[model samples]
Target chain A: MTAILKMKGLGFSYGSRVVLNGLSLAVEEGEMMGLVGANGAGKTTLLRLVSGVLKPREGRVELAGVDLPGLRPRDRARLVAVVPQSPSAPQGFTALELVLMGRNPHLGLLQWEGPRDLEACRRAMELTLTWDLASRPLSSLSGGERQRVFIARALAQEGRLLLLDEPTAHLDIGYQPAILDMIEEIRKETRITVLAAMHDLTLAAQYCHRIAILHEGAIYALGKPGDVLTPENVSAAFGASVHIGEHPVYHTPVVLPLGRRGDDG
Target chain B: MGLARNRRPPREAVHPSPGARLLSLPYLSSHLAVALLALVVIVIVAGGIGSVYIPPLDMLKIVADKAPLLSLEHTWPESWDTIIWQIRFPRVILAVLVGGALAISGATYQGLFRNPIADPYLIGVASGAGLGATLLLVTELPIYSHGLSLLPIAAFAGGLLAVSIAYSIARQSGGLPLTTLILAGVAISSLASAAISLLIIRSDPDVRPVLAWLLGGFGGTQWRDVQIVLPYLVPGVVIMIAYSRILNLFQVDEDEARQLGVNVERTKLILIGAASLTTAAAVSVSGLIGFVGLIAPHAVRLIWRHDHRVLLPLSMMVGAGFLVLSDLVARTIVSPSELPVGVVTAFCGGPFFLYLLRRRGRVTL
Candidate 1:
């Protein structure tokens, strides 16, 4: 498959401290890639770099063969959409209004959202199962419902690539799988490339076509779930012992951390 | 979390038809029409019942006589004609313009900062204009000439300078932090206010007029003053209203807005410049009228939608009516002795705001 997103030797720093250091990765079109790492492994930073929210100090990111950093923000948004981790929903905005804002890239400065735009917004909300909540203020929604709304907003953008930064963070277990299922379904139908930063190893392995393990701002391993999620790689990158087995339902690799370096029962 | 579970399911199912939304086209136009009607009624009532009362019918006649197409017979006393035509008319118009400018700018500032409490004067306009007006009052310069007063110009320049310093200080490599910007503005405002105090102490004899101007009243507003402010106020308000839809996007975080194709930095600069210009123009004419900026937009949000397209124009009309009423109370509450219009606004707005907070249990925006 042709690569839809290419990052070549990306480097980013906050002041003197380095966050992402010469990291390179590529995501093929219509592929669902899971990014797994420990805390501060630069997963969010990498996504920001790819989305052009933060510029790279070294190397470059190209989305659909266009240099992401070179394009104006409006142009960049047309090719890529991001679902931020635990984004604060704006108060007083209904779910529909928030979703409609995703059409900003497609609209001119003075243009209002017309019937076609509303139809798109409605479709996105309906797909996310948030159509009934269109009139409800964001502050009133549950965390899981709000996350679905944010996913709908990204869907409404109609971009070819989607970057989700820990989309399931802060969600309860029941809602987490539902959201992931919805995203997987959308990917199957729309064929949009997805790069999701996933903290839940077993869930990521179940849903993703391939998994990339990041350690110290570099990819330590990249392969199918069963190959890349070996105990040795997991122990090395996460510095914890884990039991790896096949999931009962899907026969995919399942990861369960045993304990820290030295923990006695 | 508990509230989320206990709360009723959203009122409607997955997708209600667009027609059911209260902010639809017809409702919005009707809301605007009602607000416009309220403003006209308030203007007529306020014009008729100032310190000197002209009957409502006479007020209408005064307005009609000025119309080019309709020539009405002028049967009222000549001095009443002068009071209605020359003095009260211009003062009411100035009140409307200045009030509308401050309220609209206040709404823009609140949206840009994403804080409901943010007001037009939060960016140092009041203190800077106060310093400039005080300096002009004390210096005994040949300020009034050729139908121009240097006081307003100096005040406008000072307001712009203060905001520029605050904004530059608050800006960082990525974007402006709202907290830093507000803190910087407060620091600059304090410095300007200190300078004004020093000037007041040095010019002991002229302190009374300086103090009066700082308190903010429409005691001697003339048609000339209205003419002077219109050039800045009209265009500034129009530009602000034009950007209302974009202003709604700013309610989100800057990074989010940028990701959604908003030119965040450029939009911020343009909005800040327009809001400052409008606030400075209003301040130069009315001195430091507090609470109109804070209360007018909040009042609009309390009843109507928070969308800026609806909020901005309705706030302008509400603000105009509010100030005209406040000025009327200022001139009439004590009859021969007048209170500053600013005092009346604070007295009215503070309690109304507290009542809203108590009623809503928390701020909505």
Candidate 2:
């Protein structure tokens, strides 16, 4: 199977400080991978590079074996849809209208949203379980509801690759699991590969087929979540005494940090 | 959260009003019908009730005489003919064009800044035009010798220069930061204001003409003024409308817009250039007609939905109709002694603004 996305010898810098240097990664078809990182770990930057929102200072990024930057915006958009951390919807557009914007890449030069576009929007919303909220303004939705709406938009893009930056940043536990479940469902149903930045280690370990643990702008570990989220690696990365054991319910790796105590001489 | 807590429904269903619930997508016809009717009525009433007070019947006659298909021998009193033909019509047309220009410019600025209170003059256009007009007046450049010929060119040059400076300042690292543009505009406006004051202080005969122009009026708009404004207005309005697609993309975030196949930098440059040209053309002829710019778009958005495709074109028509009526009121309110059209617009716009604030708390700023 061809790699859907490949980054080779990539480098990025902000003035004197380098973010991603000589780092490379490839994602094959039909995989749901989680980008695990702490705050300021350059996970967002990496996703931006893949989304074509930022220019890579060195090396090449390819989508489906074709080089990036040469593809037209519409063409690239047709292949990869990105869900930003927190993107604002223009005030007063309903959830359906917002989702229909994803179909913009497939539109003809002078085309307005037609019956087919509306159908696509409805299907995406239905899949995300946001069809009931179709008429509500995006601003009126709860944080979890809004994230689903963003996901719905990505789904409506009909792209094979989806890039999500911190998709669960604002959700409570109930909603976080629901969102991850929805992403898993989407990947399975549509065969669309997902690369999502996730903050919750348990959620990442549970849902992601593979996880890349990113630290200080480079990948510290990339493999099955069982290997990557080990206790020693977790301690080294987050500087916390962590417990790594199977989840009580899901049988996935559960990371529990030790509370500060007086016995740690 | 607390406010909504107090207003919790008797039942927990999210649907508030089933009857008036918005459709999944808003359509144009129902939303625009009322505004269009009001605008039409306003234009008709305003066209008849100018300083000369041409009766509706006689006004129809004058129009009939001009119409090619209507072969009626419509005769009017000589004085009425001259006043209607030579004075009021051109003034009304100028009012329409000027008002349309300013309102559209204001709408563009509001969109560009993503702020409701943003005005066209936020970018130093007013001050730049003021400086150019003041210079012409103080130097006795013989520019304004033949009606309003030189005013547009001078004001256009000045406005373009100021915008170029603001644009340069706003661009720091290839991207145009909106906050930077606004700050630069403020600085540029202050500089132009200082220049104007200096010119006024050392003026021959106190430079009252420039001051009156700054205060704004439609006192002497004529056919010549119309001629000078048309070249800029037609092209500028066309370009603005053509770029309406880009404007829609602008409502999205900048990076997102770029990913949607818009070249953001090029679009901004085109929009800024067109808006500035329109402002210069209008300001040169009518001096500095104020609140028409700010109010027309607000009224359109308040009355209708917030789709710019409908909003932009309707705003133009509503703007034209509004200023014509305001100019008519300015002319006829005091009979032979007319108030400045700017004063009428401000008086009307102020109360409307206050009402908007009180009623629609979300839209005030």
Best candidate per DockQ, number? 1
Error of 2 at A187 (Å): 1.3
Interface RMSD, per-candidate values to 1 decimal: 4.5, 6.6
Q: Model 2: clashing residue pairs?
A: none
* Residue B35 lDDT, candidate 1, scale 0-100: 92
lDDT of 2 by residue, A1-265 (tens): 5678888888888777898887778887989999987777788888877777778888788988877766777787888888888877787567776787787788754556677777777677766777778878777988777888888888888988999888878877666776777788778889998899988898899999889887766778888999899887777667667778898888889987678773584
Candidate 1: residue B338 Cα off by (Å): 1.8
Best-matching candidate per lDDT: 1
- What tens digits encode model 1's per-residue C-alpha lDDT throughout B81-130? 88877888799999999999999999999989888889999988888888
Chain A alone, TM-score per model? 0.96, 0.94
Which residue segments of model 1 deviate by more than 4 Å?
Answer: A260-265, B1-25, B363-365
For TM-score, the strongest prediction is 1
What's the residue-level lDDT of A150 in candidate 2? 82
How far residue B12's Cα lies from its native spot in candidate 1, in Å, is 14
Clashes of each: 3, 0
